[model samples]
Target chain A: MNFSSFPKESVKVEEVIDCIPVGVAVLDTNLRLQAMNRALEAMTGFSREEAIGIDCSHIIRNNLCTQKCPAKQVLENDRAVHLEGNIVNRERQKIPVMIHASVLKDDEGKPLGVIETIEDISLLRELDKKTRITHDFADLVGHSPKMQKLLEILPIISQTDSSVLITGETGTGKDLIASVIHRVSPRAQGPFVKINCGALPETLLESELFGHTRGAFTGAVRDKPGRFQLADGGTLYLTEIGDLPLTLQVKLLTFLDDKEIIPLGGTRSARADVRLIAATHRDLQAMVRQGNFREDLLFRLNVVRLEVPPLRERQGDIRLLMEYFLNKFNRQFQKKIKGFSPEAIEILRQYPYPGNVRELANMVEYATNVCHESIIKQEHLPDYLGGPWDEALRPEVRATVGEMGSYPGLEESIGKRVADNRLNWREMERRMISEALVKSRGNRTKAAKILGWGRSTLWRKMKQHNLV
Target chain B: MSEKLLITIWRDQVAPRFDLTSEVLVATVDSTGEPLHSKTVVLPTVSAEDLCHMILTEGINTVICGGIEEEYFEYLSWKKVKVIDSVIGPYLQALELARVGKLEPGAILREEASQG
Candidate 1:
């Protein structure tokens, strides 16, 4: 007859003898190893002949499961127990492991010691570490498919130390991208130094990029380390590369070309083992054509071009970024704000964000400070954002019946004729407002300044014109 | 229906003291005497066709402006709008003059001029 008809105890023995991933052991009250499977032999580097009838401690190398171990805790307490930590393999290398034990008894309900199983968890722990590192940059918020694509491409790009050129409108996260590149690169342990080419004059920019000796200039009181020197063996981000004055462009090109820098007022040239990353909002090719920029310099910087699309093109990202900044500012300012009201978010979505991510960040920070309730209301947003809230209150169809008939009684025929001759005031107003909004990025105060109106006057006009 | 013409006056040329050097005023008026519409654009310069397109978009058929560049005037005349030359006034005044029929087509002769 087939042994498949065998009783439960025999099956229990057979099942324990065949379980694959786990190393199972059966022991009596004396803690002697009774039975083990092929998996146990593979896990412990022992055959059945060597393992059977041996003390369980011989294989686990502990004196209590080897002294009062997890198995003992379960046996003494008559409950289950679990323990996790590193375990040494046959080669004596530490492998992460987990163990669980439960008391095993005969039909008479007497405690027959415990049965324990061990599982190697080294690969799981490694996967966990990898996941945590991946999650580290998730806090850098952006959700446009373009941004998502950029993020997707970042790791592949980070694997190599090729020179990268990041291009976008002002306030786009070019510097943040540079940081991400550095963090993911092999040089992550080294320093990351950043220099703004537009912030300094040409003479000073030269000294800042390449360190100077004592008395390099009239005011040089001592030797100073430039960004490249400070970022040796790491990454150096040169921002506004388009603005690097032509006189300094040659020096920068030479340094990037030769991987060396000649310090001001110094005869010796120093090797800089720095990875070059540059960012600019300006059109370098147009500048090259205009003869204001160096063509060689452009070629050197555009090795791996990363173009960050404008905010308007990526409207879906706005809400994600807004919520991220809201949470960030809530924690920073110790506020209890929940998030933007639907109306406020709608208004924000309609805005054509010329200032890009930086402007959105500033708005969130500003609103968080002034919000009283958990939910950020429209009024809490700066006037530029809330200004459009008033606009939303107006009828969605912009052309009103009143505006349609307001023309002086020239018959619809004569009115159309007169309207044709009349200054296209409405279109003109719309164009002016659009240009002003673009220049100011929805900031009514700045837009008002551009339009030659006081703050209060601008508010009144926004209300009057239904332009909020 | 009679056709209409469009005109655009350079903001700097219209208002000498304002910082609106980058703006252009667009107006749409019919050939005889009816007000159509007007708008402002922030552009470096305006050409005759730029003015004509602005008016055509609003269905206007007549054009008027102050200090027409010779090239633009010739192009505008060729495009069938009465090109008003040597006229100088405030933007609204020019429109009102166009409205009341005070401004008339003085000279429409063609002359060689720089396209720019």
Candidate 2:
């Protein structure tokens, strides 16, 4: 083949430029497209032949073309110009791009044309936005030292396909962290299947986790795929793993060993490509020692254990979570309650929320609903907080109250009524409803609002208690 | 049968990129290639999906543009619209070729005198 007939230097230059990953375009002094690499052709959806002899602006229709032409700038200044802009591609999607343009000079140092390189930064921009929203990890919101450490390791853990075990008290956001791990993992695009092992009985839980074929059991009328099958190519979050029965634990251990699941009453085992993430509020180690949990299964799941700090331990995040939920509920319920009063905030800070962040969120929600004024007051809180400061200090400090001042009003009222053999919860509820109705001038809706109960709920309660 | 043909336009020539073109010329031509009605439409913003919707809504049978992505090309093809893409030349010449049904894909119809 007479390869010499081809312009060797031009062909070599084209090949070299084409090999470059980023889009590159060469324009003549008149800003007409003289040449462009395959990357540029793909980026702009303009073929080399179609792009040649056309205005570069027409080929690369970018925001900068009309506003700040880097090529034109380079030509005028005889220097390199760099810019970040967006280009509308063939799909009409605006791709964030960075362009570097420099004047192409001849041997005589006279400007011949301009060479420009374009890079698509859309993915980088998307990651930057995600990082901002996640505060380093996806959906894991906390800046406390413990949370910060967890966030630091979350990315590293997400990179692997190993089984993860997250241990935290109830309402400490274990599910949230599990999902964040899945979202940050390579299998983010795949399904994230979650099941509470404790929520179902042993027989039902087995079928739920490993699926069941038709006629597998008495009620198995049709073939059903389970969590493992649903989470193929993704992550399966098994919450409350401590409650998994011993027989189910053995099966789970087998599945973990072989990455295969045998559906109930099925003779054959099928492969499942799923990353397992387990969570439990109970002490699995103690369960293992007590023979309630299998040691082998524990070893398999406890390869990496992440402990989520309780809300009381991370005191710094209390206000942050309060403000976050306040904003969130404000948008949801259309209320503009400014914030908690100083006394109310002090009470919240001193209170040891055994239910963790979930309890705090509920408290804020209740306050937001009952608060008629700009700020959340102590009176707006749930009665569990006790009547007032004096009422809270009367009782000996309860274990559940932590080191905070005691909630004496709740204890005294319940204690006195129980001691007198007259602590009828029904009677007390009826009296409370009657009081609320009288305060609202017998208006059920106003009464419901005052009591922080939905109108339908108040109506149902009234019917149940014969208050209507 | 009178058929509608749409051409993406830029300046006096066909737009070099289909998705970037903000203006289009739609012409209704008779079986003999004689123009029955012709109008130029300007889009509020350039968008390929919007343009596809417009094409479907306007009952355009043929589309003439410069370059197009494979997905949009396949989409319009799937919708049974004839797409003559990668065309480079003055708009009138391309329009004339389309009228006679002689225009080919990747056709470079710019005369030597008109070459830049």
Candidate 3:
């Protein structure tokens, strides 16, 4: 009789033995089992019955694996051992397994019993092993000189334990810089705390930064650790530092000056071993002069300043960022989009990113969801990102005045533009003066010569424009 | 490029409600029409005060949002971000009006509005 032609029960038992998901055992060194299929349960019919008390030799046709048996390698060596698919079943089929074995030894190190666990990874074996690359840091993609300079300095910045101030446009990844600093720092093992100064109200911001005790205010019921306290022994990052209220500026400065915090409604101060990193898109120096920000605090925070260039300024990074986000959203939304069309990429490159990196990511994610084809075309992006073909591509510059005519409407359109006009003029003159100044390298005479203006006229213009 | 014209536009509630705080946008031409830079700054209370301070201390020339209060106009005139008061409209239209030197003060400057 062919064992292959055995009844369904026998075949089921055989399948259980040969194809059991994980490792199984029927044993008796002296704890006798009448019969077993495999030294490692090669074929699985034994479900706590039929094989218990059966002799191993009669089933597997192999005696109790001794010191030399491959199965007992770990036990014999008295060391932890690992095994892969090596065990053979009664059906002579091989099955994948990982056996972690350690000796069950007596007090004198004499062997007593042996045990091992097994894990099957046949599914893993069948898989093609697709590579998974995360896009978390991919968000920080850039290869421009400015970005390269930043990347080079990031490790250096991380090495130092000084307070850092990051300045850039709104979406220029100032937070990314802080995070990268924390990740690359010696204190990487410590927690990284982030707070948006612009997001919270002044009253809540104080409590959020320094934490508060029970009965501190109407909302405080229990003692809570503020961001500074929670970030102790780590790094605390404050974004939009320019928006911080004047009242909190004093307290924040005190914390930075001395590594101590006074919690709301708490009597004494507590030490907080945290590194401070602050960022803002605004001109803090101007704020300092205006007395909105404390000059002393600005000095404390600007110990090491890192400037993140805006996306439009670093056009080289656009393609890379687009691809990174495309691949990410593809995997995320489980779409089969190939990539962006060349035209689409061109449009992205040419478009001045007013909103910067965060906006680019949002646009890419939106395009991925809306586009019908495998590749994203220019049309798939929002109208603002496209060219003149789309009406929304340009800023709302009305031909005639008083079109909207409402106070706020007029304010939004006209007010900003009038300011833009004067700024545009000043900017133009400033740029010309600077270019002339740079070429002349601080030579008032040569700058006058290059611009072809009379020496007195140049001097007067410099004084009037404050370019001197 | 004929030196790109830089203009500062202002509106009555522009500074307080949004970050119209010295946001400089470039004026360029595409196929459609006059295009301004996309970025804008909303002056914070402190920064607004700072802008006011610049006029006082540094004597920096300022382009006000359309129709600043009289005292602010007076204070700014005294301090000097050369308060260019004009009628509020679309940014380009406002700039054009300022460019031709046709922009005129729409209302008498008030001390109360300036204090706020």
lDDT of each: 0.66, 0.82, 0.62
Q: Which run of 10 residues does model 2 chain A get worst, by summed lDDT?
A: A393-402
Docking class of 3: incorrect
Candidate of highest TM-score: 2
Looking at model 1, residue B109 earns an lDDT score of: 16
lDDT of 1 by residue, A297-352 (tens): 88888889999877767858898889889888888988888777888888778865
The sequence of per-residue lDDT tens digits that candidate 3 reaches over residues A421-445 is: 6688888887888899899998889
What's model 3's TM-score?
0.46
* First chain of candidate 1, TM-score: 0.56
Task: Give lDDT: candidate 3, residue A372.
Answer: 78
Off by over 4 Å in 2: A1-139, A387-468, B1-116
Residue A21 in candidate 2 has what lDDT?
Answer: 95
By DockQ, the best candidate is 2
Clashing residue pairs in candidate 2 are: B66-B86
Model number with the top lDDT: 2
Error of 1 at B108 (Å): 99
Instruction: Give interface RMSD, every candidate, in order.
Output: 47.6, 5.1, 45.3
Q: What is chain B's TM-score across the candidates, in the order shown? A: 0.54, 0.95, 0.46
Residues A1-468 of candidate 2: C-alpha lDDT, one tens digit per residue: 112222335456667799899999877777877778999888877788776766776677666774478988998888899899877555545678999999877667777788899999989979875774376353466789998898888889988999999998777899988988888787887899999998998899999999999999998999898899999989999999999999999999999999999999888898888999999988888898899999989999988999999887785889888888888788888998999888888888877665678778888898888988999898998776754432332122222233223334555544553444433667888898999999999999999999999999999989989887
